[model samples]
Target: MQAFIKEPSKHSHAPDPDRLHIIRLKNEIKLRGTSSAEAPSTILFDVLRSTPLTAAFGLPTNDALLQTISRERPAIQLDHHVRLPLILRQTDRGESFILYEVDSMVIFTCDKNLSGLVFVPVGDVLKAYSSLVNDFDDEDYLLLDYFERV
Candidate 1:
């Protein structure tokens, strides 16, 4: 009788550790590339950096802000479940500003890159936008700019 030889399996059922490592590295690289291109980190970093609004506008700590939000939840006008970031443009001068609302306080950055942070109570959001524009306006800027959430 001839001896029969068993053939080797074409594929392994178990995952290869090296292959898994390669996949992880590829995912990390893709994430890093996109993050740098969109530069969303600036906003995220600023959000953390400006915690408690950094008291830049005499605002209370994050805990205190949350308390205030709960207290004034009824009056606050938020269309969405969460207040998204906003980009406001000056009507007259054509300057742009970015806004992020944390609880009842709104954080403002004069430039999109978020070079500086300024904040105001949610109630004064519109006025805050106008104030920034007026700061650079050659003439008195009577017109107000509206918030366009991004």
Candidate 2:
């Protein structure tokens, strides 16, 4: 496995080690990696770092601004049934009448490769491409852009 350098610690402001932002939450407050149940850390890391969603928006999100999903549940049974929606929004306009936000951004890098800075909320990304005809028949971006800018 290749070594990836971690970004400068930004969670230093938080005095509690458990409160550190190792990974932004997704639904039930999952860290970027997995829990004690997961046996292989390598596979867990790959699934997160390689996902196109991360590639586009970058994973282990930046310290400056992070898209928070939510907190984890202490109860395993209750957590198992819960599902959170991922919403993505794009504010930038480009040549492509219809642009999939994921295609525009690159994965986040701890090693200082800021290749792509764009990120999309999971729900929005799915919604934008859900219709998928490829032509900008209607203004899909009407309300979407605001989610990213503000």
Candidate 3:
């Protein structure tokens, strides 16, 4: 599958010091370009940038993915008994998701950094983020995607 990314418009004369972030769905046919004349050869997300190959992952060996997720979400405090997928979304207010990490229900996080990851125990803030991400399983989650700043 082919993948491309488009960054949000607006030159940051001073940009957002808050760290704007978004999620890009891979494997989705939506990112495979289109099958028509005049169609672009690449697909892109206005909020995502093409990631460097070296940044995809250090190496997919011995719990590499899990280790990475843990590194990004050390505060989630997950357990083996909790087996549910958490969908991560980007928001103007911050980062968000629904998962077994905080028991149940979706969580809207303002930050994913070690000190910035805050859990919204209950609220309607995350529902408004419906347009930000496609549903995804939590068997494995990405920590580097947009969570990492340039």
Candidate 4:
């Protein structure tokens, strides 16, 4: 059997370094699997501790963050009345997903569903994950297509 190799398109732009970092982090989390004993929230806390953006984001490496995340059911609000619950893990697919809400109404959502990192800007109010996913064509959002190949 031959191992197939895929390459990026010649016309496609180069990947962003920061976005690449985020993708790598997400991949690591997926591979390890996030359980109570090995949750990505803990790993993310550690990563943010060493990251330069830590001071700006004020991400504390503590259980409070995790508690806040768990206090409410994970859901993405698309509009004033529409909200969709998100699964933390897809057991059948062996995929671990996580979402972090950062300052300035920015949200970091990583999942094998999209096979990469997705940054959504909610701007003071929450919105639907699908709304941003639908705007993948827009240039304003930061979307790193780490798994897509040509």
Candidate 5:
């Protein structure tokens, strides 16, 4: 998937440190476009940018995602467990489903089967587990769709 990165302005003005920093951040994100071999931190950034749903959460290989969330909302502690409503969608297929329940080991998708149950392992969700233990808000959950984009 193509990353929706904004082009930097081509102007020479009084160098504002903050503006330069912002430009650098944008450039860094562009460099880390959706690729096959992605770092855990890049995965987290792409995930958040891909979707508007803010109901996704998981334990990434590193604490980058967690640190960002915590920094954004300090009321939440590091180990707080808050059940997240898993939302899944295939961007290429244009299909969407809501997984109502997420456990320590798996997430139960909206898919129904012979046993009236369909589930995806927690590990498969970008190699992270959704233990319903993450204290993330609806806005914070938008990062979950990064898997489909890549």
Candidate 6:
């Protein structure tokens, strides 16, 4: 009789930890049947606080602003065929701004007046969401150029 010992494979196909986290988040959202679950806010805050944009650009997190955000669920909008859940708020300076989640990881902030857009990536956020918008094809050249500059 011959006995054979099986060795473990050198290649592992496990998903990346960040990707796994996103998958779990999506599952949780699906299970809840609405994106308004506790997960979205928690995930949003987690991403916001950790992003370099917040630290470097002085992203507002004051209690009043946060309270306004928590007061109501954001309205989802379809822009250029992309569905984006947006929280529209008036800044302290009376400027209208929109904060929308991108790719379930990063949040993109845009000025309602088409001033500029800021891309804030959460921890290990992916760029896969760009494909959904088709690179903002419906936007004007100046706006597209502004995005390119950002």
Screening candidate 1 with a backbone cut-off below 3 angstroms (N, C-alpha, C), the clashing residue pairs are none
Compared with the true structure, model 6 gives a TM-score of: 0.20
RMSD of each: 20.1, 22.2, 23.9, 23.8, 20.2, 20.9
Question: Which parts of model 4 have CA positions greater than 4 angstroms off?
Answer: 1-11, 34-36, 50-150
Show the lowest summed lDDT stretch of 10 residues, model 2.
Answer: 108-117
lDDT of 1 by residue, 9-101 (tens): 986576544554434433443454344433333433334353433233443354543343344323334347555423232322455453455
lDDT per residue (tens digit) for residues 5-90 in model 4: 98887789765556555545444444443333455476556655554552433433446545543443233345443322344323
Model 3 lDDT, full chain set: 0.35
Q: Write the per-residue lDDT of candidate 2 for residues 59-145, one digit (tens) a residue.
A: 354322122321221333322324221211222342222232243453322211121223657766755544332433347455335
Which regions of candidate 2 deviate over 4 angstroms? 1-36, 39-44, 53-56, 60-70, 73-150
Candidate 3 vs 6: which has more TM-score: 6
C-alpha TM-scores of all predictions = 0.18, 0.16, 0.14, 0.24, 0.21, 0.20
lDDT of 1: 0.44
Q: After superposition, how far is residue 11 of candidate 1 from its true place, in Å?
A: 99
Reference-based lDDT, each prediction: 0.44, 0.36, 0.35, 0.45, 0.41, 0.46
**Models ranked on TM-score:** 4, 5, 6, 1, 2, 3
Please give the distance, in angstroms, between residue 100's alpha carbon in candidate 4 and its true position after superposition: 38
- Judging by TM-score against the true structure, name the best candidate: 4
Looking at candidate 6, what is the lDDT of residue 111? 60
Model 3 bad stretches (over 4 Å): 1-49, 53-63, 76-150
Greater-TM-score candidate between 1 and 5: 5
Clashing pairs in 6: none
lDDT of 5 at 132: 30
Query: How much is 86 displaced in model 4, in angstroms?
Result: 28
